[model samples]
Target: MTSFAQSERAGLCDTFLEVGPDAPTLCSDWRARDLAAHLILRERRPDAAIGMFLAPLAGRTDRIQASLAQRPFEELVDTIRSGPPKWSPMALGSIDEAANFAEFFVHHEDVLRGVDPSARRQLDAAEQKAIFAALPRIGMLSLRSCRVGVVADAGSYGRRSLRSPKDDHGNVVLTGEPGEILLHIFGRTAVTDVELDGADHDVESFRKTDLGT
Candidate 1:
């Protein structure tokens, strides 16, 4: 079966084709071409990609990504469409599903919602299940700094209490579809559709916390 990761990759490429290289994306200061280049760089250049996690090497990663951005926009999108090169561990069957699903999904929305703020989509049962399955891990990463306890209320997918590294007495219940929840966790909170339920102070504190990117 074609995974949501693959589907999101294709959809992102299609959007890239539609919007062209100069199009805006939610990623700070990145155009469609730049975002495509980042994806390519991420999957194809491990040496440079290390900079993404390591602050000291970030300059090299930025320079390499900028160089890649100068390539033809169509070529960049095509490279992404073709999937990671064989040399990339992301090409492994399991890693592809585990890693790329949210990566592509969020970047895909970066394109779509960047063009139009109201352009969110609904996920099917399987798709929701896919995103829901990932919520716990992402929740932990995203909510670690939250002062109040965090609980994801993903409607039919049920709820998950996140691991907040520092917690006060209050709890914040984040209510939304899995995709919207994921988007919020990914630092797209301004555009995300999730609702927060908690004390005024707790909700405000949760809002003040930085989420994923």
Candidate 2:
């Protein structure tokens, strides 16, 4: 799965290289190149040794992301495919690997949207779940309070929300094949065919929030 994801990430980067300089991306202020630079930077962070020791004080993901955004695209890609950072921990578990996978998958989609819309359909179930699980951990799921039904289908796993939480302000009936819903919620704005309710602005606002936007 990791190998597949890395290949996808590389493919996404190649797609971005073809984007015109004037093209816009989901990241409003960023051009396609800027987004590519950011992804590359993300993969090039200091080893886990330095990260674990100093991350508590200076390892803000946003800061790290911003710092990466400043580099040139080619340099960033070279860093990502290179061997793991020297200080990285040796005993990373499944969850950590999942997190890494999610990072590349989500950002790949984000960049693809701006460069090549067709790239969105390239994702598989394992990649989708890794993205789904990772988004919430990074605060992407906290976009808005809506009483929306959520149905997810990924390979053999399927789940549906039977009851809306009390805090929800409106109802959004999100029912579809699991992978579709996963794609919709995780930065795929083109999934307009999926069911949605409440004010369009609310949904749009949710999309604009810091979670993934």
Candidate 3:
């Protein structure tokens, strides 16, 4: 896992450096540099760190990005590669290592969408596991409206399973590679690409509720 994390981190750093200053990202308002800064911040300050506990009031994303921008690009990448600071307020303890892998995998995809789409192909099983482990916590399924089943392509990173309230009432079989399923559930853009063996409404509603605005 450490080796995989290092590889993913290196890929991410390379992508960040490769993206032009004017490049846009899937994150909408954030530019490529902002995305790079975000990753650096996560490496340095995890949720369990002191800053998170103290300013508990301050928005973590904002704090991290602000800190990242304070340094030059070379310094920022150097800091991330050096690992989290010992005195950071948001360290995740023993799990900090896991968080490192998780952030790299997810953010790598985010920045890659703008810089290099092929970069995602480089993710290995370990990196996928780390990102998958973090998904449920991201609120992909809103129990208030639906039940989701996620299955990944034995080889993809964005797999997920989701059923709408209506689909739960009838017989249906919705299946796809994990990455496609997850992207659809997150209301990203995979729904059109996934195959539905039953009523399409279930997938439609799920997308509408989560991915669709």
The TM-score between candidate 2 and the true structure equals: 0.59
Model 1 CA deviation exceeding 4 Å by range: 164-167
Two-way TM-score contest, 1 vs 2, winner: 1
Clashes of each: 1, 7, 19
lDDT of candidate 3? 0.52
**Candidates' C-alpha lDDT:** 0.87, 0.50, 0.52
lDDT (Cα, tens digit) per residue for candidate 2, span 1-213 = 365445655665565566633456666677765665555444455432244346574456546665665666566556655534555441244533544554555555566565555543645666555544543343334333324332233335444442243344443445454434544665465632355544675444444533232
- Cα lDDT tens digits, model 1, 1-213, are 768889999999999999989999999899998899999988988889899999999999999999999998888988999997888778887889888999999999999999998997867889988898898877767776777888889988988887552545588888999899899888898898899998998888888888884
Could you tell me how far off, in angstroms, the CA of residue 79 lies in candidate 2 after the best superposition? 1.4
Q: Tens-digit lDDT track for model 3 on 1-213?
A: 255456667876776777743456666677766766766655555552345336654566576676666667767666666655667633544455544554465556666664544334643556556555554544333233444333333234544433333435432343444433344444445322455543466545444544421
Top TM-score model: 1
Give the C-alpha miss distance for residue 25 in model 1, angstroms. Answer: 0.9
Each model's RMSD to truth, in Å?
1.4, 5.9, 5.5
